[model samples]
Target chain A: MPLTINNYADGILHGVSFEVQRGENLIILGANGVGKTTLAKVLCGLLPSDAVNIGGMIPSQTYSEERAKRINYIPAKMEVFDSYLSVAEFLSLSHFNQTISIDEALSKLNILHLKTHSCQTLSSGESQLVLTASALLHSAVYTLFDEPTANLDPTRMKMLFELLKNDTTLPSKIIITHNLDLAYRLGFDVLYLKEGRVAFHGSSEAFFDQTHLDALYGSSVQKVNNHVVVAL
Target chain B: MKKLLLLTSLLLLAAAPFFGQIDLPLDKLLQSGTMEHQVFFELRLPRVLLAFLVGGILSLGGLVFQVVFRNPMSTPFTLGVASGATLFTAIAIIAGFSTFSPLFAFLGAMLTVIVLFAIAARFQNYDPTALLLVGIALSFFYSAALMVAFYLSTLQESYEIMRFTMGSLDVVGFNNIWLLGMVSGLLLGLVYHYRKAFQALLTSYEFAFLQGIHVKKLSYTLLFGVSVAVGVAVSMTGPIGFVGLIIPHILKTLYRVSADKLLWQSFFYGGIFLVLSDLIARNLGESDLPIGVVTSFVGAPFFIYLLLQRKS
Candidate 1:
């Protein structure tokens, strides 16, 4: 089953469309304010648009287990409202895939010590770890993570990179990020957004070539030893 | 500490109906023909039961409103449900339909809910703050309309309206108590049924949505159920304030748990809080004080203390 978006136009995105086949991961790269998050929301049914469909089902129209088992979206930031909702409690709520235990998910992310802590008390990086733990417990078919490495330290980022690269957690993952090195290393199909449109949709090798990098990032990026890096 | 508080509260609830201006001993209560028995059955029992049920409904309603609106201060009255009931009751008194004031009050409450939901359907996004603001605006409008009713009424009718605004628990017999019991039971049942949804909602709306919960529909259903039950309770007791706002906060403080875990706790403790307030209201003076006045006077200071303690 493939995820497809056709002729979708929210205020920010205009006629943007694409598809990601089952078991095929994709990376969404874009400049600031290019409607990356908006598109992610549309795909996950958070924004409620009829323009996107997942596995022959309209995501926004379907609900409950049917929709949950199809896709999961990990937001850029942890947005917990209750002050007393512990990490364990939160993970338990999303434990739809009963095969994985909350403790196992927490340990997988090296956040077992933070399990009993209130989510409101967690630091940004810690909360990101908790969110990753939640996504593992959620274990949907296709999980879209927005900027998963944005707040991570180098070590945690590498850990997350390994998770994405190995596909140990979920089957198909759509990672939205600005980390060019991480994206290049992951070797997924790339969907580049610019001015609210898909400026490029191709393989990592083609998207990361020097000519393409200069075209997209201008003089701000440089490819060194097969790794994309900031020009400075 | 928990067990001690529970024991004391239960003891107080049991002892409440026995004490009044005219005291009834156990012997007199057991006697079938005494005035003490009549007062016990007719006056005190009904009033206590009414206070308990109304208190439970209002506090549980407050918990639901806070979760639905994502506002700590939001209560059943925050959406102008009580103000609507008050205004309609004032109209009934001024228009010589005072006997049907309960029915009018109920109608007013349900009508406000219908208007709120109708406006909610037109909201572009599921933004609860916008709905809360609409409720506040409606309350102001209802208050202004109530002033007009006060201005147009006879002195006697105006006084009746004033007394209703003060809130009373002057129930006569078992009939009203049974109705209120049913409403409270229904509200409690609904909350229990949706307990998991409420827990999911206690997190962010986006988080709840990602968990396969229909956040909007569940919120609307919970809000409507609580509002209708609160409307019924308000029609009977004339919009008792502070019970809904304070009891949940107080219970959360005592239990050290999330709002979802405190649904039944809020109901039990809320019932006790109102019963205690009514006990104080009846025994504090020769004439019974307005239950609303007693609750606010007791609730406000305690709520502030809890806040201050939590901060420090």
Candidate 2:
């Protein structure tokens, strides 16, 4: 999709374009305000950048309502639903026959132990992870997670990547992440945006190399052992 | 489906005449169609039906505000729509617009809600808190008008106005049951048509939009439906409270709390609570107190208890 600048240039999501394939896992990498999140929002049928003219189809456009019809988005915005709903209660309430039960979803995420817990009682990491599983319980054709592995340790990160990349029944996945390892481990295609423009589009192997990442992220980028960091 | 059908059947079989002191010996009454039964049919039956009808309307109306505001605390009073209507009704009556009081009350509420929406829309972004604040402000403005009316009124007028605003199920000679019956059916259909929008509201506005709910459309329709339903109830029986605010919450707790099921069940529980509350209110004293007074006395502390329970 071709994105541009206009009246709401501040809101004009710059530097973004690409099409994702069926059954593929695409990663969006960018520093804060570079428009990775904005792109995701546009695909989710949120009105595209106020500047509009977000260009056309992604034969490469990884996100679209056609894709969205089957998409499950794990927006960082969700907390726990605590209005008299336990984890179990939430599962049943949201179950529309197409999805699995709460316990089943939890078990898939390996958090079945939390079946009876209220969201408020759960720790932040637990809440985040559980919400992710719950969001994906409906398992639309695609799943988009905005910084999904934020607080999860390395093990859970690996677990989520495995689920996203290897899901035989699921649609393609586009995960927006700051964590380079998760991005590296779970990639089929990668799109890196800088200042709202696509800086690089290629495979994980091409983008994961230290030199490319450093160049895209600039002086703010650092390498500590094998982990890539975009300094806040 | 069976549960709903069964409840309806039970409600019909049990009708109002049997359970109270004014028992109609059905066999004897039907045989001669006695004056006692005629009066019972004329009076108490209509009152009971009116109670059920108004209760359902208010409860359904309250659900609309709660869903739209996404705040459990909002109702006609908290949102100021009820107070605005009460003010209009009192002012209308003081000016001797007896028959037109209901229409005046309804227009007052509808106008207040529209103004509240207009003010909220002026803010750069949507925020529930902004709406709530605007609602409180609007409600206070109209209520102040009502208070001014109260202060300048004669003692007899004040007494009549007080009773009306306090709300009651002691309606005699007129019951808007026919109108309510038609409106309730229409409102129920409207609620179901927007079922998905209400469900999406359970998450957040952004998310609900993603689910294909046009925000402005759903909000306007829901608000309009709420105004019509609650306006009719207020015009018919004053502003009976609690039955609207509490019944839906209680039904949500009893059920799974999903927006879809919650909407449907609220209708049922609203009827039950209103019928039962009306029964208690009318029978508790020799002369019936207004149903609003009963609901407030009952609802205020129960609401406090719910808060305390939530805190714990």
Give lDDT tens digits, candidate 1, residues A74-96: 99899877778788888888998
Residues B7-54 of candidate 1 have per-residue lDDT tens digits of 998898888898888878889788999988899999999988888888
Off by over 4 Å in 1: none
| Tens digits of lDDT, candidate 2, B1-312 | 548754873574366545554656667566546866665666677777787777777787777778777777777556677887888888887888857887888888777777777776687655667777877887778778888999888887788788888787665554467787888888888988877556556655665554344665577667767776776677777878777778777666546355455666677667766777777776688777677777878877886787677668
What docking tier does model 1 reach? medium
Runs of candidate 2 with Cα error greater than 4 angstroms are: A1-8, A11-25, A31-39, A47-67, A70-72, A77-108, A111-143, A168-172, A187-206, A212-232, B1-34, B113-129, B173-175, B256-259, B306-312
Per model, the share of native interface contacts recovered reads: 0.65, 0.12
| Per-residue lDDT of A56 in model 2 | 40
**Distance from true position, residue A12, model 1, in Å?**
1.7
TM-score computed on alpha carbons, candidate 1: 0.98
Instruction: Report per-candidate DockQ.
Output: 0.76, 0.23
The i-RMS of candidate 2 is 5.2
* DockQ agreement of candidate 1 with the native complex: 0.76
